[model samples]
Target: MCVLIKKYKHINTNNYNVLENALTYDIQRIENDLKKNHNSDYFLIINDEGRLGKMRKIQRINYIPSIIFLSEIELLIEDSLPKASKNSRFIQILDTISYIVYLYCLEHFNNSRWANRVRNKLNFEDVINLLDKIKNNSNIQASRTNSYGIVHYPR
Candidate 1:
């Protein structure tokens, strides 16, 4: 299995709009960054022979991860955050992100993979409480394509 992760070991906090500031600022900044990475009108797809053999016109929202890619995310997250006896806050945060991606795929694509066990493990609307703190009633406040999503979502 292939996994790519960027460990921000030494982040210059000033250069980034972090969690301590207004959540709105972070959400807007993330949205703007996603806009900058937009792919062209056509997207390349592989054919039955396992080769890059075709290109199809796509809508902007077609930039979403496939089941196989989400499976890879499950693999990588396991490596990064193992099943510990007691979960840490950071681990919970990462798990919330995984749940977000998993649910988004299910809701938007009307597709899901058996290999992705996140939804099975989660209770109904587990992240709902997080919304209570925010004045804006956005169900999905923010989403960023972290390494794998950045590479595979457009394919």
Candidate 2:
């Protein structure tokens, strides 16, 4: 499944009309293409539209960092379970971003062995670093490539 998560600040919703409009457009395009190609992939959109109460608790208590730290530990957890006990949503997002980074590198450096290097060096710290790098690069490239989207239009 391909989940596209948009994590905007909870209170910034009202000011994100343009972002919402662009998200709708991209989601529609993804859905249409998935349908047309008969792909099993799925797209999901997650926003902080109605989670103010939860956000407030985390915000006021400074619990967000602990939650994130727990997330990292979950990714490192091991068991006889069906899959990693990590935050499923976060794992899924990380996987998707990692795949995108590999794809980008494959396309950009046809002869380089960066993918193999990344796979071999995939440790907890390195993986976190890799994810951050990929997320940053993906955001940059996505914004640059999607320049013609509705959000870029002057209202």
Candidate 3:
């Protein structure tokens, strides 16, 4: 006989059903308690000792999959660059990466909830404007560096 069936064989049907429900309820209650005490997020769990070992374990499990997804998006951006005059695809990818970073920040840091609020307030046009400013600054910096005859070494 199955272990569960053998263990519950002495209980009447109604009592068995009640026992099952109680067990489920107790499990959920325990989980809620743990979450409340630990300040755990969807992807991370921090214990009372303030160790992030469990969070690192969870991140390690999903790291490869996240990298693969990011690489695919990078390939899409590279392909779109040749055919589209507007770098909308690149901007979209940048926005997605920013959102992912924002989510990570929210999950990992207790005080970073403001980042989520700021990210929610930003729109596509805001992202595009930020990108334009970044490109202009980079161009100006490059010209200044060139004028100074400074060679940047790859680290």
The lDDT values for all models are: 0.31, 0.38, 0.32
- Segments of candidate 3 deviating more than 4 angstroms: 1-86, 115-155
Give lDDT tens digits, candidate 3, residues 36-155: 554543222222222233223322122112212421111011110112214456545544544543443333332334455666886445644554444532222212333211112110
Q: Indicate the worst ten consecutive residues by lDDT in candidate 3.
A: 71-80
Ten-residue stretch with the least lDDT total in model 1: 71-80
Candidate 2 lDDT, 51-140, residue by residue in tens: 333322222112112212421111111211223414467656655664654443333334334557655855445534655565533333
The TM-scores, one per candidate, come to: 0.24, 0.25, 0.18
Please identify which of the two predictions, 2 or 3, would achieve the higher TM-score against the true structure: 2
Q: Give residue 81's error in model 2 in angstroms.
A: 24
Which predicted model would earn the best TM-score? 2
RMSD for all candidates, in order, please: 19.0, 15.4, 25.2
Residue 15's lDDT within candidate 3 is 54
TM-score of candidate 3 to 2 decimals: 0.18
On a 0 to 100 scale, what is the lDDT of residue 45 in model 3?
A: 25
